[model samples]
Target: MQEFEEFIQEKMNPTNIFIKICTFLLLCSTLAYGQAGYGATTDSVYGSSLAILSSPTTLPLSPAPAPSPDYEYVNLTGLLTVAGPFSTFLKYLETTKLIETLQAQANDTDEGITLFVPKNNAFSNLKKVSLSNLTSDQLKQLCLFHVLPHYYSLSDFKNISGSGPINTLAGGSYTLNFTDDSGTVHIGSGWTKTVVSSSVHDKDPVAIYEVNQVLLPEAIFGTDIPPPAPTPAPMVAPDIAPVADGPEVADGGKGKGKGKGVAANSSTPSSSYRITGRNAWMWAVIVPLFVGLIVVL
Candidate 1:
């Protein structure tokens, strides 16, 4: 009986060992599958999508805004209204309706307008018969004669000067000769010659200069224009100032007298010479006296 029990135990022990070996093999396979599935990045199901996200491509961005235009707005009516006390000129412009033509030219940026406007007093000083005898068409041409169809800055006239007569807005023979003398712009119509007193309004596409006299065109007033008034004699008279920048400045006024100018400073040098000679004489006396005292000692 003991031998039979021992044999049965040995057989059961071997079967138990076989079962444990199978269990160990199954556990090792499960651990290797889990490591391969979870540890490797390429083994993931989302690998392709992750690769796309990690790529070095440029992202889409919002486009930039458009640039603005360079057009400037200039209104003539509003400008002349507040520019100065040229109401007489303004009234004539309104009555003739020439402002529309001038304003239209001002609106164009490419070919702008340059105008010469006279003050109220200029019209007041004008002879009534000159304007009173003009027909509507003649008056319109006369007003148009005051303006140039092109824009010219004050400095630009320097080059335009002495280039023969340039065309005015009045067209045809109604031309004006420009002379820029020492930075001053002078306009010469056949009937009237005037200079730019001041700049009323200066800007791109529009330039309005103030003139002392009303412009009368030869087209309206005829070519029998009177000669320019003779220049007034200098207050100093010809004998007073023989040359330019003369020394009339003795009394602190510009006398333009060269001799007087030198005379103004001549007193100072004479005074300095007198002081120097007096000091030299004093020094000579003192040095000799000191030398004599030393010798005596």
Candidate 2:
């Protein structure tokens, strides 16, 4: 019995040692595979993040907007006060308080004003009775007659000219007539006929033109405008062609005929040639008639 037990112990010891060695190898392989997988996953995640951060290309951000501009105003009083030695007209405007009205019109953005300012002498030269005789309302109208509510550049005169009388700031028949001759603009208010002799200030929103005479309205002056002096007839040196003597036929009773020629002058050779040509033509016709009459008789 002792010998049989010893043999069983020896075989069991060899089998147990072989099984423990196989189990240890399997655990070591599993630990190595897990380490490799974690290293690869960590490297891929961190490397991708770093690559994105280092790249030169960047996504664009939204843009901002731009801004706008401002308004412009013109000064009228300053323009007139300096441009014209227009003190006399300005005095009338101030006295009538029409200057304020004109200044407001000049500043208008859409439609501006045009003023025809007469020189100082225009006011002085007027017959004393013409202005002195007027009432307060008439005086105001006289001042108002000089302004056109709409701006009119010199070139723009062509369009409004010949359109009959244009209404002035005075409103009613206290209007003025405009006529454009070539580029010259003529203003006729019946009593006053004048021209835009010069431009004091010509700009958008304000235009002040200088006139030689104050615009005299027919509404104030009686319509009995004097008959315009007749222009003397032009003297034309006499055209000798009309009074020229042509060839005359002299036929005596004896049936002999002679042609009398037009007397030619040395100074008028061209005219003499023309008359000779006409005389030859006439003689040709008259001779034929005389020959026909003689044959019939």
Return the top candidate by TM-score: 1
Q: Model 1, range 238-273, lDDT digits (tens) per residue?
A: 556443345443355665434555545544443434
Q: In terms of lDDT, which candidate is strongest?
A: 1
Q: What is the lDDT of residue 245 in candidate 2?
A: 44
TM-score of 2: 0.52
Clashes of each: 8, 0
Model 1: residues with Cα > 4 Å off, grouped in runs: 1-68, 228-297
Candidate 2 weakest lDDT stretch, 10 residues: 251-260
C-alpha-based local distance difference test score of model 2: 0.81
lDDT of each: 0.82, 0.81
Tens-digit lDDT string for candidate 2 (1-297): 888898878757877778888889889999999999999999999999999999887799778666533324556566667887788888788888887888788774468889999988888887633687888888899989999988899999999889998999899898888999998999999878899999887877778899999898878877887765599999999865543544332322222323323333223344424667789999999999999999999
TM-score, cand. 1: 0.55
